[model samples]
Target chain A: MTQVIISPAKANSMYWLGRYTERVYLELHLLRICFDFMIDGKPEEYNRYLASIGNTFLYPDLAAIRSGLVHDKNNPVSVLACVEMANDNAILLRDEIMSPTLGYIQMSLEYLRHAAAESKEPDLDELQKLTDWMLAFWGSIEERVYDERVKNFLRLGKLIEHLDMNIRFSYKFYRIEEAFTSLLKCYDFEPRAFSGDALEDLKKLITEQEYDPRDPVYVNKVLLLLGKVVIL
Target chain B: MQSLIKNRDSVNRWMERYGVRFGVYKNGVFNEQLFPFDSIPRIIEKEDWKVLEKGLIQRVKALNAFLWDIYHDKHIIADGVVPEEFVYASKGYMPECEKVDPTGKVYSHISGIDLVEGKDGRWFILEDNLRIPSGASYPMIAREITRKVSPITFVENHVADNRDYATILKEMMDDMNGGRGINVILTPGRYNSAFFEHSYLAEKTGAVLAFPGDMTVEDDIVWYTGLFNEKIRVGAIYRRISDEYLDPLAFESSSLLGVPNLFQAYKKGTVAVINGFGNGVADDKGIYYFVPKMIRYYLDEEPILHNAPTYLPYFKEDYDYILENISRLVIKDVSEAGGYGVVFGRDLSLEKLSELKELIIHQPRRWIAQEVIDFKDLEILESNEKVERKADLRAFVVSSGKDVKVWKSGLTRFSRNPDSFVVNSSQGGGFKDTWIMD
Candidate 1:
């Protein structure tokens, strides 16, 4: 066997792949609603819905979200950009994921590249095919690779991205719980002590009964929930 | 079939999918690019391989003996086969490793020797890369993909299967470990030149790919630092970094890339460092002059392979010869590898030749001048056109449990430019899948 150089760059790569792929998945889920509103309901109503989510600056108009996700590589939140990020991270972490999975990523990138080059509004079927391939790529990864620490780190990246995008509120709470719980069970983290009052506030968010999703306290509640679950 | 042969785009795509790449740094920025593969392959006959295998094993064994002698008794130096100045002055000579025996052996556990066949059809030694030689995993994997893509081509030919490289590696790691815990592969990072290869072999051999930060030294043993729980003991580390960069405490005090106290840990017999320190002593370009002598002294047998006719500029007579025939020689700096610091006398103008002669005279010990051999070229398909380029084979020899096994296939790198004889892949070169008939 040949001598291999396992560097920090590769680890960051694995960590980033976990984050960007999940970002793509989360955005695709959001696009379903964005697309539905554009076709069936009014674009004005969808814009209002996006504004309520916060970071409306990312996709301010429903029509913009519908047309811009696949077209713009400049948009940090765009699907095209997310896939590009995934490809970059995948190459960096290529040693951990093995070659077969990497082969799938290369194929998926080519598919997206061709789709973006030819289509204005990419056919939903073609978009779904690329999405499905990306998901399948992740699925095969779970089956074949078995380093729990590496897996949990990847999940930590995904969860953090979800929290950043303000999409964690819509995510199944149990999924976040499972990810946090697994991080706790698998690795013994040595974190620096928190000196601030966020701890008490986080405690109140979890213990208090009025932490409801229907109120204007949506962001506060989600933050408290995410914080309580993660700060082991 | 014709379409397959002419498909440059498909081959490039396949290279990306298979991850055949080497990293290069341009203007202080690192970039990874595909190591272009030519559809054409270099074939070796069964009879020829038999001779080549014997020669490689013989060469590697003598190198191993030389490394042992360097660290232990200095008998070779005492016997005056290799000059004391050559042993002590060479940058590869490590004084810190004196009297420290690793697993009761001192030579390299892994060696990648570069060789080329001259126009006369005789194999000549190009260089010996005993320090962390790469590109074995490349041929091991590329051959598999190549065979899969062109099954009929494989069926028609008698190419030796290159899949056992990982198994051979496993055996080597295990032999060094003495049945210890898991074998871990230490990589510099994915940005390193052979990062793709590092990852592929780690996966294939079931060795955990670990970075410097991933490891910790405790109780004199090396363990993988876990994020959550128990740290697993790493018995053997097939490190890819050079010895000077492996342990900051032992070598370069300012190097952040190395694991701290790694040398002390290895000295304690807690971990094994494959391709041991001081292996580089035998690979120095000046050391090439004495390898034939070392073989004769150590093994009492004649060398099977021949070194290119070389002149040691350190010798007055040889310096005179080089100065007289300066335009016909290939000059190399003893300290540099990877196609760097090599200058062809024929390519230089008269003024440049005069300047080189002065430099050689000023620092004679720093250089070696060899008679240029016109090696055979291989046909490579680049942009739908066939071109011939100078190529050389880097053969990997792995030693485990008192046995040395030579992998059948080698990395056959070729220069992309027609007039260029240099074939280091980092210098805008490409590689061909080498086929060794058994």
Candidate 2:
């Protein structure tokens, strides 16, 4: 357990790893919620779910968006893109995170690639598989990562992104509080100077703000502050 | 052999799942394609390996001594065993590396010596890749999966276990730990051609797989910085990057991939740079012609291995021979590598041959011509059938802690194109494992 010096480049990469894993993990959650819509002949239902995740263009319709998420290599928010990025960062952290721990991420990416090559539609079954892998990745992060500081950094990213997604989709009040609490726990392990004021502000907002899904200005500000809260 | 061939596809599938691919960049686009594995292995008999092991060890010892000598005293050059001008004129020779000695005076800790078996069944040394040699990990990882795919093959054959490459590499790095800090494999980035080997070796050796940006020099020592701001001192860097890009200040000032003042840390003996900074002089194409002389000069021994029938245009007699037999020889530019800058005379048109002759005559020291050896071809699986392909072996020799050891396995690269003799992975060549019979 050599002391981990999070170089600027690696910190930046891990920050993105956190965001991308959460993006894949949670986006698939959104897709799973919308999957039944597409399959039950209620594509508009799927379109509304897509809108909630900030997808502006619903044109070219259900099949395209459904397949695009899992199949498109260029899709910035695609599951394939997110999983690939997560695995790439994991490669950088090969010493910090073992390969058997990264096995889940690798399998998930390989599955997505195979489905794309086979021209399989993005369906509930594939979504479930991705969900399982993402969960396993988080589990591995907790159980397998050697150094506590390394785990803390990854968890910091994961928690920040979890908070960002929670705010973006306006999850239930209890879910927001739970994610916020988890982020606080992970950020405490970091031995650097971070904003206690910012954390306190965000905590106050979470506890006191009126529940409104449409008024995301305050939520966006909190997200910005969350990005800044981790100092490095 | 039959069962191994039958299960080749499954082995390859496992390889794919394990990301056993090489990266190539062309026209500014990077593509990672699998380094296809052929089922038919190139087997080396124990008796043959006995001779090869001795030769490889002797050759590398000579090469390492040559590197150390070239950097410190000029005994070999001053004695006129090798011309001083020829030694200094090589682009691989670094003037900044003068008088710097690594731990145990081992410059090439790991050496990839390329050899070919002639039709007469005698092996001829083709190349010495002292500067940042690769491909050991290819066979190491491939054999792991192949063994799993067909365990019966190993149970029957008296093959030496190849899985000890990682252990050997770790011991080498650990023994060469000059600063007693962490050992790291410094790669330029994932986009480099051999990134897979870099990452895989790091994983196998438990060394930190560090990018150029992930490390920095402080107080004349190298340090590995992790994602949580924890910094560990790095004693030995098994650098996969090229020499020119090693340190921006000492070599290519424009190379951001290199750490600033890292060469100074190495110079101060605060770090051990495996396959030391100025090894190119020993493995230089022009200098390769002088290896036998080096063996005689340094070790007072006769050369056990034979270099190919080679002609250096820099010499008067060799130049006359090259000029006379321009159509029957293979000319290689000393500066070019990875199957590039190699031209067989028969493959050249009459006009091209004449142009090459002019280039050789004017820049005589730039090229070396060799008589083409009709090397024995090995049959490989091609579309479920056996096809004979030209292949060469790259045997890894590691000098660790005052001793040199050659691995029992090697990477056997073969040409994918039927008419071509180029067998570099960068040139779309495929590879198979080399089994040393126990």
Candidate 3:
């Protein structure tokens, strides 16, 4: 393998590209579940969904929720904004991540723009295609990116985002533990970006006998510790 | 060829899928628009391509020789082959580059020479873009898509493969670097007009795509700043930024897009800067009138290519002739490029014509007049209908050490407007792929 030199700015971009792409993918998945619940006449499920992502905006109805979560450019956590952010970073890292890998993000952004222009209800089928593209994007990265360092940085971001989202949604302890284990493996690739003390503290907190995954205080503690683990 | 044309929409959709775009700024706002690709290629037969290849190689060699001469011994100026006034007065001539030698003594590692075929079946040299010429990537990527969309087009046509452009480019960069360190393509940033080409070439050539501040020079050694603050040496830089905005401390002190001591590192022979500095003196519009003479003076041979019938206003006889034929010639301001500062005398009103003539007369050294060549119009597909449009070819020449090679395929850019002759992408023109028959 050729010696790959990743500058600080490019490292930051790669990390965020991984984070935002994963954010968009997981958000779409969560939105589908919430939309299915709303279809069953559980309209307040939208408020619970917003609270899980730490969004304070109280969307009035399903239409408002759909518009706010998917099309609103002003909302930083909106699907459109996250996709755009992923694209901006991908543009910066074009040479690191080949064009075929970046093309998936570009296609997703183009689709969302067209959907937003029509101002119709979010199409679930189209969103499924987007999720598939996101999966393809990661698959391309794994196949096309030869530099191990580049892949490691990107995977670190992906693992970090997965753990964050899993904690936010209060997933099972075993699933969160599995994500943490995968994140640690990525951290082993570039341990300098991680804090040793923070990693130990987080591990201790997660594995403690009294630890409860559903407790808000325990979840907040894990979230704070997860944020501190990656200094970069 | 018919199959390729039939699949034009599929080719374009693939282009969009690959994010093929160029950025343009209008009214201080930046916009990235897809570079429109016409399916119909400008085909060059084997016999014609042989002559063109030889001519381009000869022309670029002479130009490189001229750059070396003007910057060093200046024998051309001393022997009265090229005037001293034309050399020193050019905006491209940098006094700071008097004795700085590039690695391998190759000034123009990459040269984009523009040419137009006249109606009489003769090709005329339009311009020599030795300073950071682009558009090679447009056709390079287009060929990738065209081949994928219409496989039969390749099976039927004996077209030369242009995919080796990246290989040749990588070879040139490696030759220049001489194994001193890794090679890098220095770009201003993502907002620049040719950012796509910059990143694309970097990906293709396996060179690090570096932006401003990604590199720093300390003690005349250029280094790429790693993520953990470790410094890696950089040997050769195929810089895409213009000369004036290259090094802040050397040229433009207020330029935030340049490394502070990069020029120092280059001058110290620690780094090889591709298309070496002070090349503007050779490609200047006024200096273009002397390229044929340069060919004879430097190469001791007759010119292989013909420059357009150009008149330099700095000369007394050509000045008088230009004044008499003001309405028929095209006046060009030597300082401006990218289809700017070009005026056809016939397009000007009587008042505008008088004002232009006054400007030319006052700044005689800053203007050149050329008799517009009646170039052949190429047929392009527009709205599913065929129409003839003015087109020109930009052939890329890569010089690695003492060897020079011209890429077989060139960028065939055509004006979208029926009456316009400018084919620059900045002026809203589209491009087509140039196919060189094997």
Candidate 4:
């Protein structure tokens, strides 16, 4: 295995790549639900969908924000926004990721940017394709990325965002377990929690998923094998 | 067609062989990427290029005169042709170049003038890029690959050769050497925007690519250092950095990118620098409006090409009209280029237009408004479908000895977006290989 040494620039890219790819993966699922609801004659519930992510901040009103989120070229936090961020991070880490992986990301972003500019409601199938590409993209990274420093830094970033986004999206059990297990494995030191209250909630979340087939304990063992704490 | 483009993998190999690429910074981070090459060609006829060649020469000669006048005695300003404030206040105008003329009164030995042909087939001068203009290397390499892809295509067509750009540049450097030593291409580093062009040019011309740290000035002579304090005098430098970042002692004091006292060496006649410092005063967008007048004033010949119909908002009448018709024009900041600081009036809301109008009024000198030319579209393939998009051409004019020679083909860049009129490569555009058929 090639030892991946994370330079400062690559660290920044890893952190943002985590922020951006997670943003895209999570939003595509959210937008999929919204699009499905549009077919069911539940237009009123769209505002509830909007409220789940704080419509007032990202949009002007619910309608302006929702449409903008879907297609606005100016919005820095839309689906296109997430892709742009991913593209930018990928561009920065071209040498680290090697050319082929970077080229794929660049190509994918180019497609998404064009799609966003042309269509107000882009084909959901194309969006699905991008998500699948992103997943395959991860596998490719795992294969090509040989340096441990870069791998750990990228994993640390992935875990941080995984924890943050799963909590925000209200993922009940499995996703949260996956996030914590990743967190424990990637970081040597943990950041301060909110008076240990957040830690207590985390412990409860773990206990709640204790006996599930998709078990938290399985994650615990993976973390330990990766030289992380065997947190109960 | 598929077989022709199957050379994409081969083309990538060719790029590796030729070491062709540029560095771009996204979010303050630098990355080098292979500027993708397409096998398609944009062909022009010889008869059409003869006119373009004449106009480009006339334009570059006048620009050279303008740069000399701006740096020396302000002749254009004193003659009341251009405002003195415009000359003095322009960001590209350098005081350090004052009283120092380049060898044989030449400032722009190599000029890249960008032009575009309308649907009616009349070409309009888009802008005059007198500084270190890039993209010439792209077509240089592309021509080679295009021949490999389909050799019979070149045999059937009488294509004017474009491989002499380096020869012309070399002769120009040698002309002004004044018995000094080796000529070099001074680059900021490996991460500059046109690093590929700089390196390729150095390789092609057999000139060393020397960074600032690799050089030192002693007794008004610029000497490049070899390993461990070995030194050799450098005669001519085709530098790829802007003037402000060329020499810290001459322009910006805090510029770490610049070599200190390099301009002093230039002024001492110990070295030659192509497209000399302060040439930007001529390439300034505001200065673009006066090229035809300069041609008439200096060269006494009718300009062979026409500038795009442009309006200077600093003039009261033009300002009022641009304010009123803000929804139809393209307004650009006079000092910015590379597709930055450009606003399409049609894209602005009424309220936003009013706000922009107020800002323009506040600083009229900084703005120029132009009627958007219905720039002709070129066909490109998108998702297996032919799409028409706006594109522009940049012609290279190399001044060697006593002549301004135009390369037969130029780079034709097209906006990938169907509706976008801007085709700057930095703005996510693609290029086509231009061919001048005999």
Q: Best candidate per DockQ, number? A: 3
| Candidate 3: Cα lDDT at B303 | 88
> Best to worst by TM-score, what's the order?
3, 2, 1, 4
Q: Relative to the unseen true structure, what is the Cα RMSD of model 1?
A: 4.5
TM-score of 2: 0.94
Ten contiguous residues with the weakest lDDT in model 4 chain B: B11-20
The pairs that clash in candidate 2 are A4-B230, A5-B226, A5-B229, A5-B230, A5-B231, A6-B226, A6-B227, A6-B228, A6-B229, A6-B230
Q: lDDT scores for all predictions?
A: 0.76, 0.84, 0.89, 0.72
Cα lDDT tens digits for candidate 4, B1-438: 455455556665655434456678899998666666555567788888888888898898888888877787777788888877777777878777788968777888878888888889999998989888889988887777767866666777778777777787778788767557887778786678776677667656767666667677888988877532457888888888888888888777888877788899888877888768778888888888888988988899999999988888877888888888888998989889998989999998889888889988899889888888877788776654567888899998877547677878888888887878888877777777888877
lDDT per residue, candidate 4, A1-232, as tens digits? 2321233444557667766776677777887887677666585866656554434445444445545765665666577777778876765454456545555565556666666666555677767877876776677779887766566656665665555545544567677777776665554442321124434444544545452323446444433332222111
Q: Candidate 2, what DockQ? A: 0.45
Pairs of colliding residues, candidate 3: none
Chain A accuracy of model 4 expressed as TM-score = 0.72
Give the per-residue lDDT digits (tens) of candidate 1, residues B341-389: 9999999999999999999999999999999888998888767777778
In model 4, the clashing pairs are A3-A147, A3-A148, A4-A147, A4-A148, A4-A149, A4-A150
Q: What is the lDDT of residue B242 in candidate 2?
A: 83
Predicted candidate 3 versus true structure: per-residue lDDT over B254-360, tens digit per residue: 89888889899988899999878888888899888999888888788888889999999888999999999999999999999999999999998999999998998
The list of candidate 3 runs beyond 4 A from truth reads A56-61, A208-218
Relative to the true interface, what fraction of contacts does candidate 1 keep? 0.33
CAPRI quality of model 4: incorrect
| Poorly placed runs, candidate 2 (over 4 Å) | A1-4, A40-44, A117-119, A139-143, A191-194, A208-214, B225-230
Residue B112: error of model 1 in Å?
A: 0.9
Better of 1 and 2 by lDDT: 2
DockQ of each: 0.31, 0.45, 0.66, 0.02
